[model samples]
Target: TLNKKLIEKSEELKQLSNDLSSANENLIIKDRQKDDFLDSVAHELRTPITAIRSAGEILADDDDIPLDIKREFLNNIITESDRLSEIINDILYLDKLQHGEIALNIHENNIIETYKKALSPILHLIQQKNIHISEVDLLNQYIFEYDEARMIQLFHNILGNALKFTDEQGTIQTKLSEKNDFLIIKVFNTGKNIPEEDLEMIFDKFYQSKNQNIIKPIGSGLGLAISKRLVEAHSGNIKAENSGLGVTFTITLPKKIINNNEVEQ
Candidate 1:
């Protein structure tokens, strides 16, 4: 009986040892993957940086550059630099969030006001696309206490997506409504539809839809994942669904009335 017990114990110990070994291997693999991602980010950032740097150097040396040419060159430099900075900062911010180092500056904000403010910069894109925004509830004032900047970032990410996918002159609609103590905002776009199989993995980090690859946009494919994290940080929810035309992204934010102890009632 003692011999049989010893055999059983030895088998259990071996199994436990194997499990630990497997876990350690997985950790090593994950570390390698992270390193690869960082390398890819660095490589991607360099392209825009190179363009901006070359333009700046030329502008610095060429005193005889035509005024119009100089202006165009300067604009390209600014645009490329801005694009590079955004991509670098986004990756760094995502890493910070993942490592629990991101801090939020929470404040009271009106959702509609915030939306309006954030959308101002992209008005040109909206107009150029001729995407008509159909409003559902403009009268509903959604005031919530949260990280204002992150909320803006989340909205920008989704709206940027709508702009990217929607075809020319397609309609994109924004709806804000209240439901059971939550303020919900939905952005619906008319364009290529997401495949059923792709929907499940769309929110995964670095997971761009196969359709997206066919029409690749200038993004790291981390926008939706980062937006999702930002929303969850505010105790909110975000989801994407096929809009019968293109795609619809819905964001639910838990809100409270200003200077009141009671939640939205």
Candidate 2:
């Protein structure tokens, strides 16, 4: 009996030690991720700042510069300044969100209306490209519980991205349905297929794909990251995959979210 007791105690202690080591490793990984995030932010900010400073210096140093050329430089400064502001704002917002400084107000509402509102900001751009937009017709309403504003933000990020990457005259579609006790929303776009390896990492902060079909680099590369966080805040899931001719983003949200201020998955 004494020998059995000793063996049991030793086993428990070994398990406890292993658990502590695993937890310590997680902390180290998190710290490393924080360092990487800061480095990426600085790297992204540098481009616009450099462009703005160079354009300003040229405009100031060259007095005989033609009025038209000066106007062009001024435009460049304005554009780069806007870009810098966007990067800073996204970083601040994401940091607060990840740290739980902000709360989500989850409630019941007409999800379809929220979806339409998400499209309003980018509708003109879609029209400009002559892209076809469609929604899967639902016989009954999808009155699901979610943070209305956050859902709009989530959809805007995915839809706007599809618009940005899709070819002119391409097609964009959205479908909403219920699976088990969850609501599933999918956004599909016609564009170049994303590399298979990048499907999952696209949600990581500051991650950019090795292959980009567009001539100019897309937005701060933070849109999908924000989308992922927003979905998770509602106890939801979001993922992307390369489809037949393009990529599709699928978001799954619980139909019933029990929330005080924050949700847990």
Candidate 3:
């Protein structure tokens, strides 16, 4: 009997050792992730700050600079400052979303109205590029219950990407439909198609495609990652695919939440 009790204790100790090992491994992974996130934040912040500082230095040190050049330097300072502000806001918003500190204002909202609101922010860029837009909606009266502001953010990020990558005078096509108890939104832009391997990583934080050739705003590379989180928070799905000439972003949301009490419901 003593020998049997000793064997049982030995097994329990071995199991405990294995569990401890797994816990240590998890802790290491989390630590590495934290480091990566902080590094990205630092890099994003430093870029704009450095630009702003350089621009400000030029304006302050060069009294003989031409008026046009001075104006350009001032514009650069303003633009870089705004970029810095946006990155900080995005970081704060993402933290709140991840920590469940922000409450969603879910209500019945018109899909078209939401899309328009999201596009408003980027309309100037669209016009400057002369990008053509087309839309198709099969749902007669498209309405869904969602957080209006968050949904606008979700669309804004995706639409911004579409406008960013599409060539001058290129076309952006959007489609909305309802099927199988889900509301689907698809955005396709004509320009460069994303590499096959990068499709899966497109929504990852700090992930950016190396092939894009567009000149646009400097970004923190958190837009798509945040959009993915927002979609998941609403019990929805977001994905991208190569559409013959370019790439298409597709979002799917449930038509109705069963209980509508859970965060993802």
Evaluation by lDDT, superior candidate among 1 and 2: 2
lDDT of 2 at 149: 90
- Candidate 1 shows a clash count of 0
Worst ten in a row by lDDT for model 2: 212-221
Model 3 lDDT tens row, 56-136: 888889899999999898898888888888888888877776776666778898988989899887989998999998888
Q: Please provide, for model 1 over 155-202, each residue's C-alpha lDDT reduced to its tens digit, 9 standing for 90 to 100.
A: 888888889888888888889988898888899999887877877677
Cα TM-score per model: 0.77, 0.91, 0.88
Error of 2 at 172 (Å): 1.0
In model 1, what is the error at residue 15, expressed in angstroms? Answer: 4.8
Candidate 1 regions off by >4 Å?
1-4, 7-11, 53-67, 107-109, 179-181, 195-214, 219-222, 255-265
Give lDDT tens digits, candidate 2, residues 1-265.
9999999999999999999999999999999998999899989999999999999999889899999999999999999999899888888888777877767887888888899899998999999999999889644589988889988999899998899888999999999998899998989999888888878888898887777553335567688888888888888889998889888999998988755566333
